[model samples]
Target: MPNRRGLPQKWCHQELEVNEMAFSHRGNMTECKWKDKRDVYFLTTKHTASWTEVTVKAKGGPTKEIKPDRTLDYNLSKIGVNSNDQCICIILLIEEKPMKWWKKMFFHLMAHAMVNT
Candidate 1:
């Protein structure tokens, strides 16, 4: 069932027997949906519309499953970014204090620059 945006309303992970995928694009933005153990949505500007195979172990043994390449790429690329965010939150010890919008943005940017360098 498609919603107003022509995307599926929901997906049931428990009842899913195979991977279900859907995608939509506008200009530079691409949105992808893949249903495995649960529904995962990916939004990106760098990835093109494509599919790729990944190996997964099932009751019958390992099987090659097709999934959106963007999903895979997003998952792989996010590890470093997530780690950076964690480090900025933990190691930098930056807390959200009441401040002006520009000051907060400046501090956040400085924190990220420090962590990256």
Candidate 2:
């Protein structure tokens, strides 16, 4: 599936799954695989207590560590395509401010357009 940014919807789902799994496992072991045609990202549960620690391994050297905060909006925006013609998925964590309403609406429209296209 694809989202508005011409990117795979799977990426958004995978991130969400990782977030949920991290919170649920707490201090247990869990493993997840996220992949597209070009690359695969693996999340291996390391340790969890109040929070979870996961190691992210991609198809390259130097494994990247994923902290709980890494699942935040700052990271999710980096997962999608940049073109208007492509589908993209983005997760935004915004404050409950009123001024953001228009921005939200715009994103909603764009997402719909991308999906329908």
Candidate 3:
């Protein structure tokens, strides 16, 4: 799409993808290949394909594993559910004093409103 100046917009940016081969010296683009039975590919322009060590706990204790920065950041960013579900959970955590179901529901809604405010 063009702006008011009649210049076309930049439609492409070097971003990340899953399961990519080792590449270096590329412009803001990188890929991470995860070891799995299936062929996995990762690509990202915001990070490099270099491996960094992170701690992981197994049956035995804490151990270090090397993974790409893009992979780690992507993994960390995933918050499975939407904010609505999270809000519901947060608002329902208070223990009620033997109240009716409807009263409990009202309090829950009130809590949700307070949090939103």
Candidate 4:
């Protein structure tokens, strides 16, 4: 379902489960094992409105999903962009200052090293 701004109106839900187990082997060595599983669902709405709300539930374990409520407003003038052959130029102005004695000496040494190499 497309909204007024031509954007899709859909809600996505996901569930994840993690399991950890530890085991001991020979030579007093121990290792930890991990397991993970996930489930996802997508819900789409065709109605158009300024705001919408959705509720979700989890099958097993405690539910940790939180959905935010919000609204969006669009205007035509804010979406304008230039794509034509028109050229845009930018100019930067700067003031020059005399370098310190140590800085001048460093640049001279670098220039001499480059020329020798």
Quick one: best lDDT, which candidate? 1
lDDT of 2 by residue, 1-117 (tens): 233333334555544433332222223553333222232333335523333355667788556454443243335666454443344344223323465778878876767675667
Predicted structure 4: clash tally: 0
Q: Can you write out model 4's per-residue Cα lDDT over 10-115, one digit (the tens) per residue? A: 2122222453222223233322122224222222242121232334365774554322111112223333323111111111011124778887666655544544
Once model 3 is optimally superposed onto the true structure by TM-score, how far is the C-alpha of residue 49 displaced, in angstroms?
1.5
TM-score of 2: 0.20
RMSD to native for every prediction? 6.5, 16.6, 9.8, 23.6
Give the poorly placed runs of model 3, Cα more than 4 Å off: 1-28, 36-40, 79-87, 90-117
Q: What's the CA error at residue 39 for candidate 1, in Å? A: 1.3
Candidate order by TM-score, decreasing, is 1, 3, 2, 4
* Leading candidate by TM-score: 1
At residue 22, candidate 3 shows an lDDT of 43
Off by over 4 Å in 1: 1-17, 78-117
TM-score for each prediction? Answer: 0.49, 0.20, 0.45, 0.18
Whole-model lDDT for model 1 versus the true structure? 0.72
